[model samples]
Target: MTVELTTLAAIVAMAAATVLTRLSGLLLLRYVNFSPRSRRALDAIPPAVLMAVVAPTALATGPAESAACLVTALAAFRFPMLAAVALGVATVALLRFLGL
Candidate 1:
């Protein structure tokens, strides 16, 4: 497969940027002391970021995906995360199969 020079350069640049971002966060943390409340807030960032990314796509996709998102959210409240995820996957598959 032939890769274009610009595409390759873009991919390499993205990788470098991602590495720099992660390394900068690690290095910055070493010099900073956070309160317990601040630490807890920092810890919550990852899931919030994940949901921020996933929620919009889920809601925008279609009826099946939207329904699956709701099912997953409700499932998450009552079941383990893994179970909730599995149920969401199954729900989407079933809904799609049924032509929703």
Candidate 2:
């Protein structure tokens, strides 16, 4: 199917807007001087962001999937980061294979 010029332009604009929206926070952080409290809050943002991104995906697949993710996260916390991720992926794969 051929996309019309106007449709293509709209898609490009939407992509640009999405990119700018994602980057706006980082840009502001780089350019603005944040207070100590703000810095602490900023430090907390990553874990919060990670949860926000991962929670739904994990839960969407059910408790077993979420448990696998949690295990992987905990392993990563206790062991090598790469190993943790590998274990998590492997756990999910195994579970899928076993028909969980």
Find the candidate with the highest lDDT and give its number: 1
Estimate every model's Cα lDDT from 0 to 1.
Answer: 0.83, 0.75
Q: TM-score for all predictions? A: 0.55, 0.59
Residue-level lDDT of model 1, residues 1-100, one tens digit each, is 9999999999999999999999999999999999999998886665455456558958689999989888877776667667877898999999999999
Over 5-94, each residue of candidate 2 has an lDDT whose tens digit, in order, gives 999999999999999998997787688898999888866655555556667778788656787788676774466556766787788788
Report the number of backbone clashes for model 2: 0
lDDT of 1 at 60: 80
lDDT of 2 at 55: 72
lDDT of 2: 0.75
Off by over 4 Å in 1: 1-11, 74-87
